[model samples]
Target chain A: MRDAVRVWVLPAGAGPDELARYRAVLDPAERARAARLAADGLRDRFTVAHGALRVPGGRATGASPAALTWRRGRYGKPALTGPWRGLHTSLSYSGDLVAVALSEGRPVGVDIQHVVPGGDPVSASARFFHPREARHVAAGCDQAVRARRFVRLWARKEAAVKAAGGRLWPNLGMPVDRADVVECADPAGRHRLADVVAPQGCAVAVALAGQEPYAVECRTDLGDFR
Target chain B: MLEHDVPTRDQVVERLTVLLTRMLRPDAPVTEQTQLMDELGLSSSLGLELLLALEDELEIQIDVEELDEDRMATLADLADYITANSTAR
Candidate 1:
């Protein structure tokens, strides 16, 4: 499973020691970006996310965690460029968790959404999601369940578009709540999407472009991430 | 739902904030100067949903064909585009 999609997630609410340890791996630019965020919570989340990114990027590219630099791609997503371009990567965040995914050569995309406590999922799904996905959201037993279903479907849709390097507005209507393999009617490309195990109150999805089968390996432990 | 009335920029931002708060339930206050895509982390799909809701509530038609995400840096920027491009359907 060497080429399996590698995913790592870390809880954003970490102690000072752990947070600083992760912060050390970030470059000056990333640290500056983090500092520019006004809220401490947001700053911490950004730190953890970039740190987690560097750890896997290091392992994937065989470079020091601090040595890797991500350049903005066509869609403005931070992607590995130059020497590290060979390793495809994507990152996402929710309320209190962040995730990073890496693939050897295939275009990969990952998204995470939190099922936060109060929102108009019924109206939201109806307004935003495809008719098929809206129906799926409506099928949930209650508001919380509906919100969970809604966000999971959204994660899949976002992951698909992210992998395609396509704008999401044009593809939000694509019904992807039914299958692991996202079969959009468009014949332009195909993506394999799966719901990865996420922390409580979060929904995570990973998408990779290709027809060949691949494993989705998730690393749950972050104790020795460095 | 004023179908024929042209909404002012302030009106548009007011309606946008109402819809956004209802959908996202964001903890932070959403001001007109707020970065819709950056600070709020509004996904493009959700942003479209917000736009559609604005169209419905404001009773205006938006030509999204030429919309550029790069120029839509803040709520005010989006409102400017709507005010300039929108017409009664």
Candidate 2:
């Protein structure tokens, strides 16, 4: 059977009661990381995101949420430590949205960005993006137009980096052809990219390390598990 | 490739401090001795982000051959590499 790339999406604005419930699922280190966040909102989001990570990870690895050992990848992406080492996963969030991606044998990455009407993708493109990408983003006639383009590229690039086990800075200078269905910068490692179906004002993308068609599921409501 | 004149230690540090403070940790104090891995919490990804920011600010391309975990151990070390490799401007 072709392993499907499973995904989970949750809101970052769960109330204190909901937050407390999800917080129970996180391990000691994750709990401590949540505590280190200066803001309650940030803490709440971290709890939800990490808590979501545990659900599928637990199901696949047969490890308890608290007992699942997470080892950091070269770029700080987390992986299952020990015998369940073949599994791959990635997580990301922006504003009130959070996302998690999982695959059995291939590395996977997911990114989500909350799009704003007046945000300046043009300036951002000029500043840090590759010259080729910067021009493409800048080609948009207005702020609203460019903002959409910005989130699309940002989400795609971030997903690519996570899939490759690399970092954003080095790849920022590398051009990503938005026109291509799947942009693979590394010849040795092939990848596939697709945009996720999300709510209004949100741009999301998932990148997987194989060319095989993946069964993509957009789960907007995971609060029932809590 | 031709050799380029290295920047003064103080110049590199000054530029790096500005870039780091703005990019990575505006709240935290940055200095030559600030540990990139421990203190600043620069994972390989964040380190690459900082290098890109540095490259953009300094208008110089960092050679892949010059970068390694050992050489980028601290803010000072990164500054030294930037100074040594950047072209004269």
Which one wins on DockQ?
1
- Misplaced by over 4 Å in model 2 are A116-120, A126-132, A173-175, A178-187, B1-89
Candidates in order, TM-scores: namely: 0.84, 0.74
Instruction: Give every candidate's TM-score on chain A.
Output: 0.91, 0.89
Give model 1's TM-score for chain A to 2 decimal places.
0.91
> What overall lDDT goes with each candidate model?
0.78, 0.71
Cα error, residue B37 of model 2, in Å, equals 12
Per-candidate iRMS values, in order, are 4.0, 6.3
Give the alpha carbon lDDT tens digit for every residue of A51-122 in model 1.
888887887788988999877755556678779988988888777788888888898989988886655677
Give the Å error, residue B76, model 2: 7.8
Model 2 chain A: ten consecutive residues of lowest lDDT: A179-188
**Model 1 C-alpha lDDT per residue in residues B31-80, reported as the tens digit of each score:** 88877655665655466667878888988776654455664778888888
Runs in model 1 deviating more than 4 A are A183-187, A223-226, B1-3, B14-33, B37-71, B81-89
